[model samples]
Target: MTATRILLRAIALALLFLPLAGAAAASCGDPATPIARIQGAGDHSPMAGQTVTVEAILSQDSRHQGGFQGFYLQQADHQTDSDPRTSEALFVYTRRSLGEIGDRLRITGTVKEFHGLTELVGIKAMTRCGREPVPAPIVLTLPWPQPPETLENMRVRFEQPLTVIDSHNLGRYGELTLARTDQVNATEYLEPGPSAQLATERQRLQRVVLDDGHRQQQPRPVPWPPGGLTADNTVRAGDRFGQLVGVLDFRFGDWRLQPQATPELLPANPRQPPPARPEQPHLRLVTLNLANYFNGDGDGQGFPTSRGANSQADYEHQHQRLLAALRAPNPDILALTELENDGYGAASSVADLAEALGPSWCVVTTPGADGQDEIRTALLYRSDRVQTSGHAKRLTSGLFRHRGRPPVTQVFRAKNGDTGVRITALHLKSKSCRGATGADQDQQDGQGCYNDRRVRAAEAIVHWLSELPAPDNLAGTLVTGDLNAYAREAPLEVFRSAGFTSMVHQLQPCDARTCPQYTYRYKGARGSLDYALASGSLQPRILTAATWLLNADEPRALAYDGPLDVTSALPWRSSDHNPVITDIRL
Candidate 1:
């Protein structure tokens, strides 16, 4: 017989007995061999529920959920003059204890019948090839030919043809699993079907012909499984679903079958909206980074020291003074830097302030460790004046240095409802080193080494600010912090270049007389380092910017003046640096 005639006869015989084989396999005892070798079964008896082992090349091992892994093994079981019966089987491991991909291993499992399909279960073990992961294959683009009325189950051809082993719907999307040949990787081709007709045609020609000419001429009719599509003819990669000439694997859970090509009705496309949510109205937001509110001696000899009686008594005095200074400004949103751990704990200090300030304020503080308290940068806001939105983000950069906690960022909504703006509070690296020159001098100059970290921090903030979507109304943005770097520093210039306007520009130097804006004092030389900066869009509405010299009148010039009296007296004795305040109108 000619090869084509032999292929046609073998296909006809297999199709006629396939249903009977499945039924017999379904009734076989556990571990019973299913469909014994053609030569081993003299009478062609079906083997079901049998434990059968077959050796073949490992085509693919894909991992899914449940720690369960699956793979496909293919071997040429029967070859004829016309066509070959390539036995492609699916195997699954209930326990995910298999070796890596591309490893050849002997899998022994029970053959089970699933809806007229055969599967290997209870995978015993596997061996590894110890190979590194290969780079993904390059995708092949081809023209799709033969545009059909609708594209359901149509076997369309492509220039880069693929052997379709399985196709099914995972929810609303269609999934196709094809065997990867030397020219293609099976996993890479699992993409959406091509929409272009020319691309489909090019893909169809890429496939290799499976049957001889004689077998192709005398094709056997195969019935569709349940709602399966009819096989009018063989299909290739680029062929339309309904057209014959391409083989398709119909997947239903663990059971799958190679169904002949058939026409399927296309469903209507549903209109959908884009994924973005509607933005909220813009509002004016301000963040204040109050300078070192240390409330301790300049010598760092306050708590746990013999400087004044007991350490606990000194801490109590310091805490009261800190709270008093905080109340004077009464800022809508306050970012307090250099908040001491208070010897008690990070939580205690925050809680004490929240309680003393009443329930209108919320405080977040970082704790300390060892003998030193965790001096953190904190955020305290008036709950009634601002609505907290997102979680606070901690920023770390070269400018901020690795010394203390990173700058914290939080978004707030104005309760007044005029403009909604995002606020960032920062405390850049400080210049406290006594003696140094050159770069060191510049560092001491507030625009050099010390300021370098601050500059980096500022740059980071600028980058973050750039990414935020602009509000529809161009709501003003503010970046307030204890910059350590003076206004003339290049880092400050960087901020200006990035669209920030300084509030200090509106104030005069204190000079001899105690000025309302001088926040720092070194050997009676008063200077301003604390600042409030605004975005260009909101700078014009700044009503007034001034510093309240809370502790300026103290005779001794001590850092803090004991405990603060919240009602009667002001708390200028809290820290060496005074509080800077600003009022703005939208």
Candidate 2:
């Protein structure tokens, strides 16, 4: 054959072999062969024993079975974005050693068709080419678009690693800091003043000692940092530090690198005392159930007209009386139960009380489930004595099962930053006083059912309390309210069984008639129902416990003597039960 004809034959043969070569390259399961890449979603082609390299983003990283840490990487920009298909073509790596969130990784392994979905088997990390670009380090700044309302727990992220070089105060309002790349040639100093003043002052204070012991006096600030922050503008310290090109986090008001990032430790002062062991502050909590603290009929029964309108007048009187009692006791924390739920109209009641007590007193109230129509529980505290460190949690029992009422609870930190206490206030089922002459039979199953429900509530509360971190330093718990269950009732016993020590039991006994321990009176018999119970852990520091019985001096006839007194039978005068108070040293 001629030379040209032979070349033509060779070219045809080359074209025929090209498709086969591409197919071989696409196949990924040969142990001896390195799989360059694999592409497919469904289960039809390259069924099994095919080694392949799949590209995806690390979606989740968690400990897997067989003592391995597994991570799931998912395919990007797929139709799965719309619905169930979003999770298709997923690869699972059952290896504990893996990258973290937002990592773009490639895995080489054999495909195992398990349950109709393709999964990677014996997967190994691969340094594959053609990956997505990693995001640039995030640059943060002060007066940030969404400046954090509070700096106590703020965090920021960046593209590149950075270190804190210097920190300087900006008056009492805040401070500023300078951060730079570890390999930067020049040093950076954070000083108070306008950028120009700061730049100039930084030169003057070139050799200043930093909190972190390291001397970070730099010749001058970088002429132009990433964010318009130079040495000229009087940027707030927080604003300047926030502008640093790295992850920033606010911990208890001080700006620092995030936990995931490298942390810069300030050098300790040799002259300063070694950090002292923190002591739990002594907290005094008094919980009172001001029973129906209203002059007129709160439920619109219209029997207590002699007192005044149930609107503002009744609330004012009760609020005033409560304030007087609070002043007398002078407790640091007060938990009030059976408060009127009069919506915004009744906001004045709490506000007035807070005002009467002083600027140091702070009050937070949660309206009853029925809005402002029912009785609600409230917490009043001396801001100087205690600071609310966490969110408030409301505790409710099974609907109408317990006392036909729900309760609220809150966790607070001592103002001195020493103690943490969880306080719960309750208003349990009250005794029914409907039909029946002034006889014992008229009491019905009110007390019995009330006792049972309270017992259930106590069991639930105990279970919840058990889950809390046990007290480390100070006694860490207290439960108070108008339990409505007398001291000797089964409900009280249930709480006692759950490690609560009743304060009443801790006090001296007195005559049943005129005892300071009696919190409630029915007909002619007086008893103790309002109580304060401390956790078994706090039994040692319980300094004093007693009942104030604010209305004990008033004649019983004066309270229950009104017209509808026969129908509703509730006292028209102040409250039938008095406030229970206690003091504990932490």
Candidate 3:
């Protein structure tokens, strides 16, 4: 053949066997477009709903039965541009396996945005030609950044040791919140306002999630926290982990790290036993959230009455769990919330609990009214240790009637001496944004919903208590209950402004103590939503204020109503909020 004809034949043959779907370098063939261009410097996919060919290395594969049904694809080379606002990766949705990590392959898919995540759907999988080096991860240090837009959908590594601040969805979603250190309430440092806004921003900048590298629901054994979480082997907020390396994924309205592999846990903050009594002569007060204690019926026939237990057996189980928690602390006074608002009639909630605790326990009756609400605050005391010295007082004015459960207070004088303390119990509006409106809506400042209402209710409580006549021999006063506000929240600020100091903060400051400093874990961040604010008089008398890890720290499967093998009558997972115990000398 002629020299030109022979060269043309050789070129045509090479084209036929070149592997069209392979992700070879541009010099070898027509290389696919880089992934960074597809994911622009915004919250959306630049080529949404459009088909595009891209060559990339798979960073994560969660296509297991219950996972995200796909894998994360990131740029394999150091081809990232100087613009720090753009993403270097994207999620590819598919029903089958595409390729393994470092395997370079060309993918043809339609770009789409799912909820808050930018991904590629309708993916056409291709076989791997050869493995390419995975891109180096972005180093995220402590105090991440106010805006993480630039790092979204990118592989990153935690430069600092990140502690698990919240693990509410550990069992359900296999996810937990990680922070530079143990997390705190924004409201605790400053009330919800402009400063609260700044603090909230700081917290957001400091926190990120460490998600189980799965997208499925209810993975039998949660993938994170090392071994599966248990009652005794619980994972608390202060629990620390080694340096983290994962893909930064933004979904469900938050930034999360889909870890490449399970990192070893430090177990620095494990489940702890109830604190021992202090040496000083004092009264032990316990404030617990019942997680919605609803008695089925006065005669135990009311299965699935309204909220809590689903059946008679469930009620019995819940009762046993709560009873264990209340008595385990050996408390002289118990401030409880979310109890069944069944009246003081026979077989009522209080009567049942009081009977279970024997004759020594007596519940303070609130005149003739049990406010018209599904749940209410309650006070119970060991009559042998202290006797009621004044009539019980309940708040009943204005918004307190609707948004706030009327706080109940009573004076208790020590049985053997004149020293006494008055206690007020309240349940404030929750941060849930179900029906939030106006200023009550979440301001996205880290303080959740209903913050404004909680602030207003706190004002009422402070005003009412200021006017309350001190009963005989009262040496101090304590305002304890579920403020439904985190530390530094507006409501908590109101209480602080009214001269009430958070006992937990006074005793165990997060900066000073390695132990966890939170009462509730929501979503994935830990903070003190349940509080025991003491007056100046009571604050000094306090010897210790601590939270018992009966709940929140442990997984939901350990609850009384959870699955059989893990369920029990133990105090673990008794409630959603950890019970706060205060040891004080009146």
Candidate 4:
């Protein structure tokens, strides 16, 4: 017989046995193998690589364009084997779109495991026997009582509330990492040791991704938060939801929930306004990470600079947002990090920013003092509120000579005859592991790469500030900017051991499970990378310290790169890191 005749004969035979398959299914007897038996009680299928016939109900049809190119089959109600240890559902992969949910299907195909998902492919025969009741969705909750593998490919409903811990991939992949509660960085609370190791492992068990059902990237209308995603309407990391009805699917190395019904999201963490200016008469200092402020030649021509904005329009928008944030606190001195490393010329980025802040604002600069890195730390003071007491100093020797950016220190005095207070702006080596070597590489202790270098930098900052000439060292000192280390990390520990108190910690203490205050958010975890640390002599003078919620909590979709996503000209999300404001009575 010809190939086409053989295929037609097989289809006719499949149709001939369709009624028998339905009768056996209704009687809970099978000419087809039981799905649970095929699944077994293990991660891999016991019937893999074997051709088998199965009668099941269609639970999900995903054969449309942008779908998963397949359909899900589950054993009909009251037809499942009495085993909770094995899933009773299987994914049927085929190009043909056939049958609706609740339609009973008798299919013969080779059972195979496709990238960890147990599925049937290369079908030889398929027949829609008749309609059968859809399988009841199994109820599941966070902190799973059983392995997800046992429930894999089954229709499950999560009724307990799940917190949205990570939304970083929401815009790109249409996925959200949800957990039983808000998750924190291990090193943010516990020291790097056995305790931290346990915390990290616990975090892994608590996570499950919520997928948008479609398998495409950057879905047309971003899903979640009930309505589609917009510049102003966002699904932030801290949002909460009570219920989710979906299929438990494992794909791309993560166990995800492909929702059959839209989950209701609650705005647990809402957008907050910029902090109000302090009322008491005091000297306010603000430390901010510019998130790499680079002006292309300080003109409108520099497109696609090394670090920051990619275009002239992007650069202007970033500058405008930053200015709004800077003006909100009405700070007397600004310790800034990640400014362009250009010279102190009239066309420099710092000069342009200073000019924008009015004539009373002037940057503390020494000719040829800025480091050779692409970005540097800077100190800008309000000339009307305080006067420069001594020449600005930069530390260029030791580890900072090549490892980290050189820190700039400037001593300032209140115009009303208050004592001088020296402030040092610092930007340490980041956690990126590219080209890291020896002890500087990630030790896997949760401190990340270049931690040893950052610890050495912290020590150097302490010693360098103490060794400054006469009047510079005589004044009370405040060290502030992005340390690129969490609260309990080794770098911050070095500063604490040196008697420099963390102003934010002194204000609001954190425990092992919860940290309410943070200046940065990464991969859905919140921690303080930007801090205001004060020397022993300066601690008592601090009146209040706060991290304004202008940046970290906001969505990145509102950033400068995507102009259509920019809804407002407000200071929210002006930078990736939030500004830490400190009020001190000098």
Best by lDDT: 4
Specify the highest-TM-score model's number. 4
For 1-586, candidate 3 gives per-residue lDDT tens digits of 9999999999987775443333233332245656666777777877787776776778767787767888888876566665677787888888766578777766777778888788878766455657878878888786765357677677888876787777767777887787877655555555566776675566666677788777767776766657776555666667788768888888887788888777768876666679999877888899999988887786878878788888878888888888988889899989999988888876888888888888999999985466788889999999899888868989898776654578999888767768778889999888789988999899877677888788788898899999998866677789999988777566777888888998897777653124366787665456687888899877878888888876876667668776424445688788888998988786
TM-score order of candidates, top first: 4, 3, 2, 1
Query: Which ranges in model 3 have alpha carbons more than 4 Å from their true place?
Result: 1-29, 41-45, 48-52, 56-59, 72-99, 108-127, 131-139, 145-155, 395-404, 432-472, 486-500, 508-516, 536-540, 561-565
Model 2 TM-score, 2 decimals:
0.43
Give TM per candidate: 0.42, 0.43, 0.82, 0.91
Candidate 2, run of 10 with poorest lDDT: 182-191
Encode model 2's per-residue lDDT on 206-272: one tens digit a residue: 2111122111232122111222222222221111222232223222333333222223333221111
For residues 1-586, what per-residue lDDT tens digits would candidate 4 score against the true structure? 9999999999987865553312233232336777887788999998798877788999978887888988899988788887879999989999876789888998878889989999989877778888887888888888997899988888988878799887677777778889888877788888987788787877887789999888998775778666877766777777887678878888998899988888888888887755666666678898999999998898787779999888887888889889988988888899999999998888888998999988999999966767689999989988988888868889988877664689998888888554788888999999999989999898878888999889989998889877887574344788899999988999999989988888887888666567767888877677899999988988888887878867776666667664235735668778889899988876
Task: List, in order, the clash count of every candidate structure.
Answer: 65, 20, 7, 0
Ranking by lDDT: 4, 3, 2, 1
Greater-lDDT candidate between 2 and 4? 4
Candidate 1 runs further than 4 Å off:
1-310, 341-346, 364-373, 397-404, 416-418, 434-449, 469-474, 507-516, 552-570
Q: Against the hidden true structure, what lDDT does model 2 obtain?
A: 0.46
Model 1, 85-136: lDDT tens digits are 2223344434555654444344556555544334566554333323433211
lDDT of each: 0.43, 0.46, 0.77, 0.83
Error of 4 at 399 (Å): 1.7
